[model samples]
Every structure is written in structure tokens, then in C-alpha cells.
Target: MKKERQATEGLVGLIPRAGALAARAGLDWFLLALIGMILLAWLFPELGVDREPLSLGDVANYGVSLIFFFYGLRLSPGKLKAGLSSWRLHLVVQLSTFVLFPLLILPLRSFFEGGEQELLWLGTFYLAALPSTVSSSVVMVSIAGGNIPAAIFNASISSLIGIFVTPLWMGLFLTSSSGAFDLGSVMGKLVLQVLLPVVLGIVLHRYWGVFAERNKKKLRIFDQVIILLIVFTSFCESFARDMFSGYSLLDLTALGAAMVGLFFLVYGITSAISRLLGFNREDRITAIFCGSKKSLVHGTVMSKVLFPDANIVGIILLPIMLYHALQLLASSVIAQATARKAGWEATGE
Candidate 1:
């Protein structure tokens, strides 16, 4: 019994060290956590799918609201107003996130119509229509020595804009995709689950904002845990219905490749637009990072509300999940490279 206890303790102790090593290696821990959750769901599908006494979906729903609440608490209105002067950067980032992305995907609809691939295409379009990531986009811009204030402003504003715009964009064709999409219900839920919490947090920011800012790390972890729960339960529901059976290895590979290509294309376009606008390097990096990111957290939460049908929800999430992972991997590398270049120049190297 002593030896058995020692072995378990040793195994537990190794995990944090492994995580630190992964961080040192530039391997994203969230990606690994996501994979672990998916595997766990695959192994014990009943836990997340079976609506037991403890339902993960319900927990995730509430957790998502809290996530947004904290997000609001962290966003200072003064900072937002201060950064509003950078309208050029804001316009480019917002346009890239909403207009350019969906437009880029629109032309491919005909190629995917009347087949199983239509779902994939719709999912990809949904991903495009979603907002820029709040946390990672800012983090990447900060790392790249970009305009941090502009990055924060754009990312926060993007999320706020998406609360309205994403549903509007998806509403145009969601009926075609899901046979019926109740824009009213989706809007209500967005207000309740996403927007309302943000408003509440913002209102209370004066009292608790300092506390929230101090514990940003904890809140981020909390956010990630909620996301993982959502991902696990989502995939569990998907596995329960065997929704992934139709997806071949080749199809997944193609999806990943498409995501990679889309990121680069958007990145290139954003960079060019910044250059055309006579943006400094800092503004360009902020625009590129903020404009190129799509929020998986928003995608997953909105999927729950937008696509009420469990079966299709998984299909809708696939592209976003892939894009989420791809962006992190690509953006981190770019951010590090940009930082290194800046450092070299600073040192006259």
C-alpha cells in the first residue's frame, strides 16, 4: 500500500514539471488539455452526454457567463476611450474580423453545396464570422512588441461587436444550414449568457476591477477550464451521435490545411492593409494579430445557442476548433520571431 501510494504521488508530482517543460518547448498547454479532454470524452462518453445529476453542459453554460463577466470587469472604459483615437487600426481589425473573413468564405459555398462538405464549409464560415480572440490576440501583440493599447482595444471591441454582429452574420444563412434558426432566441441568449454578464461586470468594475486585474491569471485559468468542459461535453455529444464517423482522416487533414491557409491569407492581407494605411510596425503587428484571430470560446457558446440541434453542433464546432489550434500555433511563432527581431534591432545586432 505504501509503494502504491508513493507511485501515485510521484505521478501527480510529475505533471507540473511536464507542463513547465512543455511551456519551455513552446508547446501550448491548452492544446494538450483540449486533446486530453477529447480523449477523455471518447473514453467515457456517458459522463458528459448522459445528463446525469451533474451535467457538464449546464456547468459550462454558467461558466461561460462568468468568463464574460470577468472579461468585462477587466476592461476599463477609460482605456477603451483612450485607444479610440487609433481609428485606422480599429477599422482594419474589425473589418478583417467580420467583413473580410466571411466574404472570403462566401465564394466557396457553391463548391461545397449539396453534399456533406456543406456542413464543413458552413462551420468554416461561422469561424470566419466570429470575433477576434480577446486574450491570445492581446498576448501575441504584447509579445510582438506591438501597440498594446490598440491590441487590447481592438480585441475587447471585437468581442463586444461580435455579440451583435456574429448572430446577424450567421442569421443570414443559418436557416439554410440548420433548417431553422431562431434569431430572436439566439439574441436573447446572447444577451443573457454573454452580453448581460459583461454589462454587469462593467458596472461593477469600479468596485472589483482592481481585484479582477490582480487575479487575471486565475481568471484566465478559470476561463480555460470552462472552455475545456465545453469542448469535452460537445465532443461527447458528438461521439454519442457518432457525428465524427462521416469525417475521414483526409477530410480532417484538408480542414486543417484550409485553416492554415486562411490564417496566412488573412495575416498577409492585414499586413498589406496596415502598410497601405501607413501604420507603424507596432500598429501593423497589433492589427495582424487581432484581425487574424477567431474566438473558439465565442464559437462554442454561440453554437450552443445558435444551433439547438446537438447533432449538427459538433460539425459546426470542428472548423473553429481546428482554426483555434492553428492560430495559436502560428501566432505564437510569429510573435516570438517579431520580438526577437525587435530585440536584435534594439541591441544593434
Candidate 2:
């Protein structure tokens, strides 16, 4: 009994230490949550997908609206205006995010012209068209001693622009290929589900803005949980339909490599452009971080509205998920390294 008690205590003590190590290594808890949710979906699809009283997918849909509402509540128009003076920086970042990304992926259209690989290209295009991530971009910029205001402005504006632009980009080809994609319906849903909540939140900002600000961390967690639930239902549906059956090990490996390559390619281009524009280090950091990221939250939420036909969604989601994981890992390392270098320079190393 004494030996067993000591053994149990030892095992319990290791867990928190292990978790601390993971945190120090910059492993995001939300990513772990995502992987766990995917596993749970694989094992038990019915819980989130078709459970009796309340389908969790419906809950996630509502959560998406609330998440955006809080996002709007946190964004101050005054701050946006203040940051707008940096027009050159803003232009470069926005163009890199919306234009350059798709153009880089355009060559792959020929490479993946047939069969299962075609979906990979489509997914890559969708990933390209996504807005820069808000929270992560801001966080990394802050860490790297970047211009926080510009990062905030660009990230927030990117998301707002993406609400209109992303769908338009995807609609171009989706109309031809699927023929089921209705641009009008997508815009309507965007207006109702996404845009309305954001407008309402902004209007009520005077009342709840402080509260939202104080609870921002909690709200971020709430946003991530909603995303995880969406991933759960999406994968559950995919598993049920065997939507991932066409993908092999080699295909997944190639997708991951493509995602990483895309990140670096954009990162290099933005860095070059920022240098050419004579941006300071802070502005360059903001531009690179904001311009290079693709938002998983927006992608997942938009997927629900854009792809009503559930059959192809798993394939559609695969590249973005891979890209999401890769960017988080890569960007965290870059941010930390950049911060370290800044510190060294400050000490005149």
C-alpha cells in the first residue's frame, strides 16, 4: 500500500511538470484540444453530430456568432483610425495577405489538376484567401517588439475585409467546379450570422466593451472551444462519409510541406517588400506577422456557410488545418527568435 501510494503521487506530480514543459516549448493548449476533439470525433461521432436533444454543431454555430460579436466589441474604431496613417505598411500587408498568397498558389493549379489532388489545390487556394489571424498575429507581434497598433489595425481590418473578399475569391472557381456554391446565399449568411452580430456588438460597445476587455482571455478560450467543437462535428461528418479515404500518407505529407513552404514564401516576400518600403523593424515585424498568417477560425466558420454539401468538406478542411498547425509552430519560433535578437541588440551585443 505504501509503495502504491508513492507511485501514484509520482505519476500525479509528473503531469503538471510535463504540461509546464510543453507550455515553455510554446505548444498551444488549443492545438492539443483540437487533436483531442478530432480523436473523440473519430471514436464517437454521434455525440456532437446527431445527439438527441441538442446537436453540438448547432451550439457551435451559435458560438461562432457570439465569438465575432466579442471580436467586434473589442475593436475600437478610434484605434483603427489612429493606425491608418501608416498607409504604405497597411497596403503591403493587405496585398500580401489577399493577392500575393493566391498568386503563389496559382502555379500549383496545374500540378493538382486531376483526381484527389485537385481538392488539395482547392484547399490551398482557400487557405490563401483567408484573412490573417487576429489574436495570434497580435500576440506574436507584441512578443517580437513590433508596432502593436499597426498589428492590431491590420489584423482586425484583414478579418473584416475577408468577410467580403474571401467568399468572392472562392466563389469564382467554386461556381464553376461545384456549381452548388451560391454567392448570394453565402453573402446572406455572412450578413446574418457573422456581420449582424459584429454590428450589434460594436453598437453595444459602450455598454459592454469594458466587460469584454476585462474578460478577453476567457473570450479567447471561448472562441477556441467553439472552433474545436466545429472541428469535432466536421470530422465526425467526414468520418461518417469517409471523406478522407482518398488521402494517403504521402498526400498528407505533401500537404504539410506545401503549407510550410507557403508560409516561408510569404514571409520572405513581405520581409523584402517591407525593406524596400523602408519600414522600421517594428513595422516590418507587424507586416510580416500580420501578412503571412491565415485564420483558422474564419476558415472553419466560413466553411459551414460556404460548403453546404458536407461530402467535400473534410478534404476542403485538411490543408487549412495543416497550415494552422504549421503556422502556429513556425511563427512562435520566429517570434521568440526575433525577440531574443532584439534583446541582444538592445544590450549592444
Candidate 3:
């Protein structure tokens, strides 16, 4: 019995190392696959596949449905209850998400006046209209010692609200470009694609919540894989449709600059607001995460509904994709430094 117990203890010690190795291997494989897909999409646009025009709307709908179904599965009543109690933190986060971003974008439009300016404006608008991200926001909040449940609630609710609010914002701004802002069509799509699946998942949550909670780790992996697929497919379509044809290195540089500016600006504003409100360490962390993030999932899904034109959709997704990558890298570094500082403070070292 002693010998068997020793062997089990040894196995348990290996689990973390094994898990890390598997993660690194999986990421390598995913990157290789992404590169391969991009190449295929670019090199062989019509390799046995028909060159018929593709509809961004259909793809967007499919992606949105899959994305939200998984989102619903992850949310729980307990999380919601905890988040609701922190109303002040929630208000600051939501305001930063919906209000401050849009205000910033209006003045920046003049910089890209001519030459693919529409694309630039569309990209900026997409960033503004998007909601706070779910995963990364929560991760950062956890790192900053923030209210985790509030971050989760704010992030999740942002996505749901963006389903309607994003379209309304776009319609107001892109009226000439998008044409006849059809609220009915937008709402119908939201109902059929997003709300329906989420409702079903919520209904099943009672029976499956325990299983979901138990398998949360596994489900997160599955969610990431699906997002990777969505990104791959969307990029492939953009490549196949020759969306990058006229875009130059200079244009990309501008887009990058815009993304960097937007992120820092939001971060500064949120931090200031938190300070003004006299929030504790945790609430400040929540504010930073919730304020800084702009959801690629929401943007991708909304672009399809709001901008049916594939070219427009491609352009709208550009800054969002850049922002997503930038935020992940930036926030990871910040979160680690903050965590280390927290540890030091706790230890009085």
C-alpha cells in the first residue's frame, strides 16, 4: 500500500509539466496549421473551388451562432449573482466600453481621408462598437486581484448587448456605406443566431452545469479551437476574395499605430476613472480589463450582420485582429508584473 501510494504521488507531480508540454505542442501545431491555411487560401483561390462571389453575411451568422452557444455554456447563475452586487464597477466598465471608445474614433477619421479611408473608418468604427472581451478580460481581472465575477458578468453582458447596440451604432455611422439600416433584419438575425442557442444552453444549464463546471478546463480548450477555426476560415475567405490586394505596408503601419493608440488611451482613461472613484485594488483591476478590451468575436459576428459586403467586413476586422493580438501580449506582461508585485506586497518583501 505504501509503495502504490508513492507511485501515485510521483504521477501527480508530473501532471503540471505534462500539461505545459502539451500546451506548447498544441500551439505549435495550431500556428503551423494557420500558416498552411493562409497559404492555400492565397495561392489557390480557385483550385477546384468555384470562383462564385461569397457572402460575408452567411459566414458571420454561422460564426456568431457557434461563438455565443459556447459563451452561454460557460456562464453560470452564481457568477452572475456575484457580478451584479458590484454595480459601481460594472457601470464604469460598461461606460468605457460603449462610450469612451466611440468618442475617440470620431476625430481620428480625418487622418485617413483619402485612399482606402473607408476601410480605415470602418475599422475604427468596428473597434468602437465591439464589447469587452470575455477570456482575456477575466484573466486580467484575476491577475490584478479584481472582482472576477464582475469582470465575467461585464464581459459576457457586453457581448450580448453588442448584438443589438453594435448594429445601431454602425447604422448611425455607416448609413451611406451600409445603406438602409434595417433594425428588423438585424434583430431577426440576432434572435435566430445568437439568442436562440444561448437560451437553449441556459435551459440545459441546470442539468449540465455541474458537468460543465467539472469540465471547464476542457471546455476552454474546445472554445479556443473553435475560435481558431473561425479565424482561419475568415482569413481564408479574405485571402480568396483578394481583400489584401490594394493594401500596402504603409496602410498596415497606420492601422497598427491606431490600434496602439486606442489601447493605451483606453487603459489610461480607465485607470484614471478607477482612481477617481476610489476603487480598491480589485475594482481597479476590473476597470482596466473591462475598459481596455474590444471583442474580436463580437466584431467578427457583428461585421457580418452590419456590413454584408465582404470587402467592408474584411476592413472592419483588420484593427480588431490587430487589437486582439496586441492586447493579449500587452496584458500578459502587465498581469505578470502586477501579480509579482502583489506577491511582494503580501509577503512584505
Give me the candidate number with maximum TM-score. 2
Full-model lDDT, candidate 3? 0.74
Q: Lowest summed-lDDT stretch of 10 residues in model 1? A: 20-29
Q: CA lDDT of 238 in candidate 3?
A: 72
List, residue by residue over 48-141, the lDDT tens digit for candidate 2: 6686798888898899999999998998887788788899999998999999998888777877787778978898899999999998899999
What tens digits encode model 1's per-residue C-alpha lDDT throughout 1-349?
Answer: 9999999999999999988766643467787888898899888878888776898899999999999999999989988887789998999999999999999999999999988788899899999999999888988998999998898899999999999999999998877666587888889989999999999999999999999999999998999899999888888888888887878989989999999999999999999999999999999999999999999889988888877777677778889998998888789888988999999999999
TM-score-wise, the better of 1 and 3 is 1
Clashing pairs in 1: none
RMSD of each: 4.2, 2.5, 7.5
The positional error of residue 323 in candidate 2, measured at the CA in angstroms, is: 1.4
In order, candidate lDDTs are 0.90, 0.88, 0.74
TM-score of candidate 2 to 2 decimals: 0.93
Clashes of each: 0, 0, 1
Q: Indicate the residue-level lDDT of 238 in model 1.
A: 82
| Model 3 lDDT per residue over 112-147, tens place | 666666676778877887888987789777876778
Error in Å for residue 30 of model 3: 6.1
Global lDDT of model 2: 0.88
Q: How does candidate 1 fare on TM-score?
A: 0.92
Q: Model 1 residue 294 lDDT?
A: 98
Off by over 4 Å in 1: 1-26, 176-179
